[model samples]
Target: MNIIKFSAQFPVEKSCIEHFKAQRDACGVVCPKWGCVHPYWLQNKLCYECKQCHHRQSLRSGTVLENSKLPFMYWYAAMHLLTSTKKSYSAAELQRQLGHKRYQPIWEMVCKLRDVMGKRYNLYQLTDEVELDNAFIATLIAEEEKDKPLKRGIGSQRQPKAVVVNESSFVENPKPGKKPKRVNHLKMLVIEDLRADTISKTVNEHVNPKAELTTNDATPYSKLFEQVKSHHAQAIKKEDLPKTLPWVNIAIGNVKRLLLDVHHQLTNEYLQYYLNEFCYKFNRRYFGDA
Candidate 1:
């Protein structure tokens, strides 16, 4: 929903809390101690009481909001802004929008949301035709690497490596000046290295075993054939990348632009969180205002 609709729906903190409670009820509240699905709502305490074991849990228990002291309105507003836009907001921008005096809490809240988004996407694996590629994004050096001499080029301390995977299929009866391949889901995973073992393990975990894979003949993807049903590795010329692996390259370029545009100085530690937010929004691009 847009800002107006969201404001109308949740005008006050109590409204947000009530809506959150309703959503949690729809998802079902399980007792943490006994693993019981049925729990009695303790209206006075704003918690759930186990029907059998008498265990009690707060509304935010077991959720990303657990241990967070921020108001429910803050989280609801953050989620709305994050999901409702094509790009993202930095923690400072979000803090200003919320009119909050603190920055770290808002930053942590956004990071936790992004973390859960990555975890949610992990539940599904890319299937059918898939494209794979590696991306090098500019990231701040780690604290421990401060003393080490920085290398130049792609291996520089400022650049971090990530694996980009896109689920795509051939588009039949394509329109003029349109992409030959259509994309479905996308994933960008931060990794330590681009070794063959690392690439193979990542593909094995995130992609279906029977999926058809396509990528440039990079040594890191040498063992991809063992992970998927078919690995069509080729030496892709610079211009041929669009035809060989269209969606993966496009995804990489778009994400790079996103980071460059909004988040200027990203750190290696939280690069994955930023990537998670990008992929989450891209995957749900069709779901308008949902």
Candidate 2:
């Protein structure tokens, strides 16, 4: 939805509260201690109390908003701003939009929400046709050296290589001079090493066992098809790609865009969190108005 419609529908504080209540109800409430059924109490107008344990729980008690001192309306506004746009905003930008003088609290809040979004979604499992590739991300190591020469290797480098695994599912219309359209479901993994074992383990963890894997004639992926039923290796130069594997190219393009646009630098320690966000957004790209 656009900003205008979003503002019109969720203008008041009460409306935000109602929206939260609806989401909370749909997700259900359980006794925090024993995980028992906790039915909503309409009279209370906040949350359900556990019948057996008698534990009182708020809708946001155990969620990402737990212990948040910010107003519920503000929280809703922040969520709306974050999810409403395809373009990403830095903490500074968010702070400006939020009209807050302090940066730390707002930054922390945005990071927390990003963390929640990271945890809430699952990656697409490639089952029929899959494309696999890897890319390196150049990240600044220090604040002082942010603008230092990167190509000359002057600044400390954090090479967090990412693996791109995509599935051909829903094909879009092909453009002129473009390869055949393939519906691609993509997942990116940030790992320590690109060893055969590491790649294999990552693939096994994310993709289903029945997936048909496709890759360049890399020795690491040569024996992978043996584990699954169908693994195809195309002997193409690194520069030249096969026409059938349009999904791989698209996935790579998306990764580059994300790195250059959304996240400027990613350290190995926090790479997974960023990848989680990317995967969540990619998976929900088609969930329009929902």
Candidate 3:
């Protein structure tokens, strides 16, 4: 929602808190101590107190807002702004919008949101046909050296590896002038190393066992077959890249442009969070207007 709509929906802190409580209730807040899935919500204290063990848990307990001293409205507003656009707000920009005196808290909050986004995406696996590819994203150091005084070539900075997985389907019967391929869902993983073990582990974690994997890496592809049902070794040439890996390529390019616009310089340390926000928005693109 836009700021106007957000203000209309959440007029006050209490409204935001109530909405958060409702969402927590929908998720079935459990007694963390007793393992009871059903817990009685104490309206007076705004906490879930256990009947069996008398364990009292606050509304923010075990959620993204846990231990956060900021007001619920801040979080609500942050979430609104973050989800309101495909191009995300940097912590600096978010701090400016929040009108907070300190920047540390706002920065931490943005990082927390990004961290959770990545973790939430881990709950589901890609199914059916999937096209897998690796792309080397230019890191902050790499981008920084582009304007170096010494024009005798730039120094080498490690480019981060991104594993891009997309749900792919080819049109069996197509109408005239229509594209023959379509890409649905997508997932991206930023890994430290590009070893076969790392690639296999990430692929196994993200892609379903029954899905077909297509990639250029013959060694890793063969290894992934044992993890998944089938593997197709399709080496995508430079000309066929856009056609073969449509969604991931577009997503990567979009993410790079977004980071460039928002942060100016992208770092390997926090690139995953940026990826998380992009993937999160991309996954929910059908939600219409802000």
By lDDT, the best candidate is 1
Q: What is the C-alpha lDDT of each candidate?
A: 0.93, 0.70, 0.81
* Best first by TM-score, ranked: 1, 3, 2
Report the number of the highest-TM-score candidate.
1
- lDDT for model 1: 0.93
State which candidate, 1 or 2, has the greater TM-score.
1
Which parts of model 2 are misplaced by more than 4 Å? 34-48, 142-156, 169-175, 242-244, 262-266
**Tens digits of per-residue lDDT for model 1, 9-69:** 9999999999999989999888888999989988889899999999999999988999999
Candidate 2: clashing pairs of residues: 170-183
- Across 2-66, the per-residue lDDT of candidate 3 in tens digits comes to 77988999989999999999898888877878888878888889898888998999998898999
lDDT of 2 by residue, 95-169 (tens): 788787888777678778877775564434567777787767666565555576644422225566778877775
Each prediction's TM-score versus the true structure: 0.96, 0.81, 0.85
Error of 2 at 70 (Å): 2.7
Question: Where is model 3 poorest over a 10-residue stretch in terms of lDDT?
Answer: 149-158
Query: Which of candidates 1 and 3 is the stronger one according to lDDT?
Result: 1
Per-model root-mean-square deviation over C-alphas: 1.3, 4.0, 4.1
Global lDDT of model 2: 0.70
After aligning candidate 1 to the native by TM-score, how far in Å is the CA of 261 from where it should be?
1.2
